[model samples]
Target chain A: MIINVRELLPFLIPLIIFQLLLMISALTMIVKQRRFKYLNRVAWIIIVVVFNIVGPVLYFVMERK
Target chain B: MNQISALFKKEAVESIRNFKLFLLLAVFIIIGIISPLTAYLMPDIMAMVMKDAGIKFELPVVTAVDSYVQFFGNMNQLGLPILVIVTGSILTNEFSRNTLINLLTKGLKRHNVMLVKFLYTILMWTVVYVFGAVTAYLYTIYYWENELENILAAFGLTWLYGIFLISVIMMASAIFRTSFLGVLFTVLGVVIIMIIASIYPMTAEYLPQYLLTSNMSLLTGETGMSDVMPAVLITAGASILIFLLSIVTFNKAVM
Candidate 1:
């Protein structure tokens, strides 16, 4: 079965959105818990903010205390 | 022996209590089986849909490679994330929850904790992966038998990718106290490696991503086994190094 790359594009946007939502929620959790003690907070914050919504979410999850 | 056995026992028992791992397993199983099946059915399904318009062409049926390709694709793109999800917090949970701190104070060696959790998660990935591969293989064999040059090589690539993924998960889990962070780090690492690999095809064989796709060319005899040896070596080496480093990092990482 051959899958054209074109057909796959339709799925990626939503996957990205879901990822962003997941990131936002994760960051919210860390923020809510008030746990921030790391040497990489700026790098972490930039990753979250730059990657768009998911960037921060992913960073928050990574930065969790 | 005690650490290995007790860790396994604890992890097994914990697996029973936690639905998170089970849920991830279920999702993985679905992706593993369905992605190939969908790819296999695509031609026929598309033909059927287009049949009404008389837009017909010879429908190419699916093969074992197709299923394997599906397996690899799903495993790399989606399955890795699931492993990250399960492993991201396996060790950290206890620390974050104030559960492991008491246990560690009682007498657990930091290395023992890392090793146990690492082994357990490896075992978990192996079990689920074997189950998924076996199911897909049986179904593939049932439907098509041609062009299966090396069943082992194709599927082996998928598992090898898992080895790399689990290693990343272990390290990421250690680096981050939370699961999301662990997964993010692992994903970021993978993407970075992939980007670097794109620039250097020579390094392609060593990339974990290649462990999933390179075997297809090898099986079809399009590339020599030598094409994949470097990847196998790199993935194995990286996995071992990461596991060890994760232990060191975990030993120092505060819960």
Candidate 2:
């Protein structure tokens, strides 16, 4: 299975981690009451998942408010 | 005009007052000096270690290009990270400490604040880069004679690529309210650029990462100026765009 998904090695794990990080950040924002809008958070979640390091880092910076 | 000059003077004074920056410059200068020195001494160093371990080894002839390659490798990984740690909190730190209030209240526009910050970062970067380059260049030429070709193009591309990295750090600093976030974002940008560039061989020459890779070829005339011009232009252009974007977004964001 490792070799079966060999070509996908880089993307899968990174993407998963990125997703988790995004979720945690978004939930933190929600709990803090800084963000009350769901659509904006969801849009950011999608972006963070797709662009790997750049997206997540950007989210970590840009969407903090 | 006075605002611009005042801002420049203020940043210059701030950088000088921060004694830690002097230490950082010393470290980078040492790295530059030691890199060429190491490449020159690797054979003896390796032989001593290997002999102590009951092993024999033969080392290949090292050239000036090897020293230059060492410079690129070290600067990209170590020196750059130090830069991030040092300058990632420029405006952010000001905001956190409320120091920016005085400056802004003195009639300095928000956009001008961002521009000055970026300019000062670039200015510091240029000073450090020239110090490192001069150290390595003098050392390399003193020991080994390199057959010169497009040396100007080679050096320019390498430095311009470095400018690209500085721009990323500045933009990330603007976007992130904290220093750690700025470092994270800038590093993330580099990694993503490398990964995407790796997907296609044709893109390798144009990627910001290629600046270090093609240094020797560009210097030796093995590659022409036309090959490197695109990459330099792209890196420089992207840097300007990122800086402008950061200024616009930062100006809009309510602090």
Candidate 3:
């Protein structure tokens, strides 16, 4: 049941990069905006950066001005 | 036509500036990428888990079609709601910002405004949809090489459902002055359709909701064109009717 990391790198790398990009963008916007209707900016930033893919997506869809 | 074009430009710019386009494409592309990757890695992941539990089982060889099934499943469960949330505020945002009143007083036709919004939202959906579909197609090709059966029909049915969903959202936003109510109505509309589909097995054949649920089967050839054509027609017809209704309601709605 050993999986080769090399064979999977092509897919894994892109997925990780896309996820990180989303996370970073969400965090940066949270810091810069500093205002949200529902949650405080600090909570929003923590949620966006900490939960990986779903976190950033939740922030964008349900949050953000 | 000129008025419609002008409003469409406005809608396009608003979508871009608000980051809806970027967020949607990013989410969909991630769905596209992860679906196939999950399918490709399923066997190894399961084997490792089973080894730890001292259990053994035979797993079916995953194919390109399996990836597509996964892709469509994600589209149904995750992608559709994301689509709803992104476009749910189309009209309500204008209402809240008082832009709708400004534009109405400036001689913008109500029906034209609704039509333009519908058109632009669909256009964005199409672009991101293609991006996601192509990404999934390329990765599936790389991992498991094979041509999918009824590929066009599968995509077409799902694409029609997306259009239907957007129309429903548009109608909801048009009728409701608040973005939250718009989203609520849209979700309620979908839930009612789903509930009816489940309650009456006979009517499921004609329900548009069937298209979303059965897309994977169509790709796998377990479902035929004959099975889906009725649902497809009903979906397309319902969408058009909803669109027309939205226009009429929007015209009369107090800004």
Candidate 4:
């Protein structure tokens, strides 16, 4: 079974775009914030950057004061 | 009326500023995209995994039903919890921050506050759910070129289940002082309903939990409209009743 990367690009692009958008927004919020609820700035940056979709969502849902 | 609109506007602005609106929309859109994408890619994924394992197998045909199943499953498992967690603190935040004190003193009716929050949350859920559902539907159609059965009823049932979740959150927030507890109880309430459905089976037709469980069957025409009508009616009624009860509880709640 040969899977063509080019053929899959259109299907994959939106997932990547939405994910990156989410990550960017979450990072922006983390950088702007002086205080966080559960963890420090660097930790959240790592989580938001590392976990793809769930990372930013966890930060937004859990870290907001 | 004026007070309700004012409260609604405040809710909107606050959610926007806090990134709650954006987070909810983004997560839901991703869920929407992932459902059909996963369904469409399942066979390829299976083949890739199987090839590495030195296993020979025939892949089951994936259809539009698989996409719908993924949509409902993801919505129920991932989407609802996120909705609850994100909006769970709607009332508790005001309570903890002491923001409602000034509004209450300024002659804002307690019921109006509850009503606006409920309406706003429902509106958000509806918009996000529709966006996710439509995306899945379009992608599924693009891949399969087949029409699904009972599309309206299937989607509408899931939407109503979402409304039921929002109402649960509303009631839980009204009853619990902390956002964590509010969210916990909302999830627990649904789990309990699920348990009841499983344990009794006889009552499954009338329980709100039936809404989420029956979607695949509804989509495949295995479940008829008349079969789900009771659950649908009960869910709609339960939502309204629970919301009104929440308003009552909110009225008596300490600010």
Candidate 5:
């Protein structure tokens, strides 16, 4: 499958940047906060990096105790 | 008056310090950007995917109305839930952290605490809604130059619905012991209102939920000011009434 990255760059760029910003912010908080409600730091790091859009948001809403 | 302002300022500063304000604004702004972007690019994306599968389909021409519909739909589905999740634990978490007791012991009136939280949360809602709406408006106009009818009223009605939701969630948070329970009760309240509105469609104009579902219709001129004014007024009234109930509940709460 030949996907044209150049063709979609205009539309995909903003979304990618936003996703990165959210992830970085979540990761910084996860690293700084030493509290855990359900999962530990390693588990949350995995979740945040693995889930992409939902991972960071889940951390922010549920795991940020 | 001084006490109220002091409390309000305290809440506002707390919200900022905790990054709730920044997080929510970012979420809403992203939603705002994605709505119109998706509406604009969906046809091409679909075409590309279909071509890969050896299928052919024609998509209808997208317009400003489509953009606004997408924006409102995203706000209703994801944005509202985010609002509930963020503020659903406002009072319950305070109770859990023992801050409520600390403030009360310091001679802060319970009602003032409740009122301050309510005012700040609603103020945040208003600002966030405006941010999303303005971004969507600018992108839609730039992409598709068309005039919409009753634009202000459409935005106003949606904002009112948001206020109504925050009121219900605040009351639920005050009544429930755990933040999770508070969120559950608020979701249940919304579901019940939806069921009742569906059963009595004729009275939808009197139901606060009507404003949320019919926002797009208002922009397209299918719904008029007369059709929306009733729901707007009802939502405003219900927000105030439920807010009062939340205050009473907070006062009687055993914190």
Candidate 6:
């Protein structure tokens, strides 16, 4: 039942990097924007940071004005 | 021609500034990467869980086909909806914001607008789809040595289905004023087609939804090209017809 971390690092790294880049971009935009369409800044930041890949996507698609 | 290119440039610039392009590419590439990795890890993960329950079952050897199976599944379930939701507002945004009004007033042909949007959607879909497919292919090959059957037809049919979906979205956006409604309509339309296909299996050959559902069989060679040709032709024809209908409706539409 033991899984080796080294065995998974290569596969995990790229996935994590892609997600991090998306989250960071979404966070940067959320911080810079003065207003959003539906939610306030703090709510959006939580959504973007907490929801992994989908939250930031929702922000970019729906909230970012 | 010049107007089309000009409008295309505008679309490109707008998508870039708004991060649509970046988001699409990143999300799809993630899907691409995750698909192969999941296929590769499936057996080990299963073993880890089964070890606790004293269930010993022999798992089949995973191959490149398994990777593609995951790829197609993720693409259909995750990739397509994201594609629809992300680009759903392409035209509705213009309408709601009245951005198209200035262009129409400045002699931009209504048909040209529809055509450019259609082309832009196809271009973006193609780029991201190919990138995702290629990434999955590379990773799948790197993990498994087995070769896939009907690889080109499988991928190409899915790509065509995506184009068909894009046309449906464009038509929906033309009819609905809000991005949310357009996405809802397109998703409902797809579901309706799938429901019909399931209820009347005889009509499955003609439904575009068949393309998405039959891809796994096609990959495994259980579904032949002849079996898929009818749906392919119907989807291509329907895409063109629906696009034309969108333009006709868009022309008569009150801006």
Summarize candidate 2's per-residue lDDT along A1-65 as a digit string, tens digits. Answer: 12335533433454355345544654455445455333475676566557643454444334432
The residue pairs in collision within model 4 are none
Cα TM-score per model: 0.72, 0.73, 0.94, 0.95, 0.90, 0.95
Write the residue-wise lDDT of candidate 2 on B45-102 in tens digits.
Answer: 7777787899865677888888887777787676766666566666677766677777
Model 6 agreement with the true structure over A1-65: per-residue lDDT tens digits: 56678876767898999999999999888889886779799999899889998898899988753
Please list the residue runs of candidate 1 whose C-alpha ends up more than 4 Å from where it truly belongs after superposition. Answer: A1-65, B48-57
Give me the runs in candidate 5 sitting further than 4 Å from their true place.
Answer: A1-13, B48-58
Better model by TM-score: candidate 1 vs candidate 5:
5
Best-to-worst order by lDDT is: 6, 4, 3, 5, 2, 1
What interface RMSD, in Å and to 1 decimal, does model 2 have? 15.9
Q: Per-residue lDDT of B76-159 in model 1, one digit per residue for the tens?
A: 776776666556677667755777787788787888878888777788888877776776666566666665676677677777
lDDT of 2 at A49: 58
Q: How accurate locally is residue B58 in candidate 5, as Cα lDDT from 0 to 100?
A: 78
- Candidate 5, residues B25-102: lDDT per residue as tens digits? 877877888898888877777888888899976778989988888888898887887877776676677777786687
User: Which lDDT tens digits does candidate 3 get at residues B135-157?
Assistant: 89899988888876788788777
For each candidate, the alpha-carbon lDDT, in order, equals: 0.67, 0.68, 0.82, 0.86, 0.80, 0.87
As for TM-score, the candidate ahead, 3 or 6, is 6
**What is the DockQ of the complex in model 5?**
0.38
Cα displacement (Å) at residue B152, model 1? 1.2
Badly placed stretches (over 4 Å) of model 4 are B52-55
Better-scoring candidate (DockQ), 2 or 5: 5
lDDT of 4: 0.86
When just chain B is superposed on the true chain B, each candidate scores a TM-score of 0.87, 0.89, 0.94, 0.94, 0.92, 0.95
DockQ-based class of model 3? medium
Candidate 2 clash pair list: none
The best-first sequence of candidates by TM-score reads: 6, 4, 3, 5, 2, 1
